[model samples]
Target chain A: MLQTDSLKFSYPKGQTFGFPNIGCKAEETLLILGNSGTGKTTFLNLIALLLRPSSGELIINNTQTASLSEKQITEFRAQNIGIVFQKPYFVNALNVSENLLLANYLGNNALDKGKAAELANSLGFEHLLSKKVQELSGGEQQRVCIARALMNTPKVILADEPTSALDDENCEKVADLLEKQSKIIGAALIVVTHDHRLKSRFNNQITL
Target chain B: MLIKIVWKNIWAKKLNSFLCILLMMFGISIISLLINIGNQMQDKFSKNISGIDMVVGAKGSPLQLILSGVYQIDAPTGNIPMSELQSLQTNPLVKQVLPLSMGDNYQGFRIVGTTYPYLKHFEADYAVGVVFKNNMEVVLGATVARKLNLKLNESFASSHGFEKEGEAHGDKKYKVVGILKSNNSVIDNLILCDLKSIWEIHEHEEEHANETPEKHTEHANEATEEDFDITCALVKFRSPMGLMTIPRLINQNTKMQAALPAIEINRLFELMGIGIDAFKALALAIMLISGISVFVTLYNALKERKYEMALMLSMGGKRTKLFFILMFEGLFLSLSGYILGVLLSRIGLWIASRMLDQNFNFDLQQSMLQKEEIYLLIAALLVGIFAAVIPSLGIYRINISKTLAND
Candidate 1:
């Protein structure tokens, strides 16, 4: 379970606060809705323990992230967090399988090939694992990133505009994959986006 | 996996990698060739001077004496009296002596006039003909014969002193009776004849003569004992007595000075050693600068790739792992450059040795990878790490939340 109390973050060069106060919890889907400049992505970053708050406390799985040292924060993020970026970033030189393997390297976990293959086949990414990220279309790359995010089966999933680049059909496919996979793994899902089309898929909503 | 990524990154930017490697190759090639040449020169000098224990010659700069008498280059210091040479030769500790008189030149090659003992001292082998037996007969080195295209029984006139156009001793044409085999020594560049021939050629000139005037002209045709004052006498002792006794006897009794070839040559190398070490330091400095360039480039790249780094960080990558990725990139460039540089150096030495063989008859072999070179490579790799350390530290400072928000 994750929660935040009066979480405040600001861009070092900006004049306004990112979000006055923000919070989230597990066992619920938090849909953060805001326009392009409304700090929706910043709020999700705070919940995911990717960014430290300028002033406030962030509790993830009951551990206060603000009070932890940098080393502890890194370990905490590795064991408890997973993130999907809007643009679907990946090491272009690495194939999809290697990208997935990287998650294990970061977590220092023994890779379970059978589990990974099962997950890849279920997500329609099994055939794409040996291909480079650059060789994939936007939808395929996003699916790879989503697969990479789920590689370690973390307790929480934070997606930053997971379906922005896809059309209606691919968007539905990606949204379904993210929602069904997160629920199946018992991870709390947080999607930061201004797209109104994805709002109907989530049960909870938090407007920035 | 980290190294593999680094290697692929470098391969992707093949042009940049090759440019850096070429710069390293150019530097290494020149340095290796110079080092190999220096090694060969030292070996040649040592090998040629091995038979002689000491050089007893006129009082002057010891280096000049060694260069003229042992290396067959430069001018003789001066001539000492035959009686003075004889006194040193008759010492109870003396073994065998070979006296050399050098004043003439055959087309820029030294024409050294000495006895058959001088030929035996070098262990001279005939590649085409036998050793000179008559007064006007001459033995040519392999280089001299090759350059002049002179064959057996061919004759050429000697020139006065060392000048190319100086007064020609045209009346004294010497027949080339022998062609010596390639020796890779200073002897390979000299023309040798009996000492009597030198005295006979300069009999009319007393300033050129050091022996008694009455006796000098008297032995003009016969090469009498007093016709020549010894230009330099190479003394070898029967035992190690010459190492201790010959120098003292020559210094105490005669106007001549006896110089040990090994000591003088070692001192020469020491003098040259300082400049060589400074050059090596300069080379190291250049390699350091190149390594820093590689580090700074990669580090700056890491900084620019912060968003990508943070994305990985958020995906569960440890900060230490990302830091090592950047560091590995630096090491990859250095190791590749070092190997390319060593290869370039070997090729350079091979080409240079081939070119020099035409004149020096030296088939110089470049020494293989030295332990010192390995140290240099390791130092280069460490320098790459050192250069990247500041940049890699940026990974720790990358705020993941801020990075993702910006993205």
Candidate 2:
């Protein structure tokens, strides 16, 4: 489970935000819909522990993360939370298989080639395992990004505008794939995006 | 995995990394080359002049006298009368005096007329035959025997002057009696003979010239004055008192001048030091420029890859690991540059030694690396670390939310 309580943040000489409380349980999906400049990316960053909220309480797997040190927070985030960003960004220097392996490496776990190949097989990109990420098509790269986020089987998965750039067909296919993968891994899935097409896909939805 | 990331990153920016390496190599090669040459030259000079304390010769440049009498690489000032050196030979402050009579050459190798004490000073053992005991017999040094392809009992006429194309003393042929083993000293390039042989050769030339019609009377008056003149005398003092007093006594009171080998060699080094120091400064400047190039390359790369770095951080990679990735890139370039520079310098020195052997008959082959080069490697690595550290500090300030939000 992942939960946040009255998350507030402010940038110097800029906007201040007082976000609503949100929670997601295992095998559940939550969609946060907002237009531009609604702080959707900032909310995803705070959930991923990439940004420290000024006044908030973040609980992942029943552990309060606000009190943890910076190093502990990094370790906790790596082992328990997965992040899938927009535009399917992969390290250009690494091949598809190495890119998957990088997730395990960053999470401080032993490399699991078997797990990587299994995820690739399920996502239907196992044949492109040895190929560079740059050579993949748009749909293929998004599927690879979903597989990488599931590498460590985290307790929570947070995605930022994952379907904004895809067409109607790929956007739905990507949303279905992300929800299916999260359910299979028994993780709480939360996606923050400005796309209106995803609003009907999730029953638990919020608009900012 | 960290290593793999570091290697991949370096390969991704191959051109910039190679430029940094090339610059470092230029600086390192110059430093290694100069150090090798300086050390070898110092070794050769010190080893060759260890026993000789002073050189007594006709009054002129003392440095020229030491160069000719001690190193055998320069021309003598003039010949001093043998009668004038008698006092130095029997003086209480002098331990031993070895007289040198030069003015002849055989195929560019100097022929020196000296006693067995000169060979003993360098510990030169005969390679094949015995030492020369007769006036017209000669003992060839190892280099001369191998270069000229001369054998024992073979006779060769000496040229009248030091030049290779000088007039040959055809009437007096000196037979090779011995060949010495290589001892890495001045003796390795000389042909040794008795002092009487050079004197007799000059006397014979004078007599043959007197038989000519026009100059017979003019040369006859000079015959009595030219008795047994020698080029110089190598003197070793019995005590420190000789060093304090003998050189000044000879310079002020006698026609002969005393030149200390230690003093002249120091003067030569002081003159060469100006050039070496300038070259060293140039090398250091190149090294600093290379370091700056590395800094600029890495800093710009960090700016361009900020999103990638943020992506890695969001994937749970530690900020320290990202910092090490850039640091390892700098270290990799510097390490490879240093290794290549050392190899290039050694090959350069080998080629230089071969050329000197073929032309000047001086051996300068040193295959071992110097201890100072280890310090140089450390310094190069420190430069690499210093260059990488400033840019790597950017890792601490990367606002992951801002960077990813912008992307």
Candidate No. with top lDDT? 2
lDDT of 2 by residue, B20-51 (tens): 88988988888888899898899999999898
- lDDT by residue (tens digit), candidate 1, B259-346: 8888999999999989887877777667766766776677657766787788778766778888888778776677777778788878
Deviating ranges (above 4 Å) for candidate 1: A1-28, A35-39, A53-69, A111-120, A125-130, B43-68, B72-97, B101-232, B235-289, B370-375
Q: Return the lDDT, model 1, position B215.
A: 67
At residue B280, give the lDDT of candidate 2.
85
* Candidate 1, CAPRI quality class derived from DockQ: acceptable
Per-candidate TM equals 0.70, 0.91
Question: Model 2: which docking level applies?
Answer: medium
- Candidate 1 lDDT score relative to the true structure: 0.77
lDDT tens string, model 1, A1-208?
A: 7777777777668645546444455556778888877777767777777667788877777787888887787677777777888888777656778778778777777766776677789889898878877889988888888888888888888888988889988999998998888888888788888777898877577777
TM-score of candidate 1 relative to the true fold: 0.70
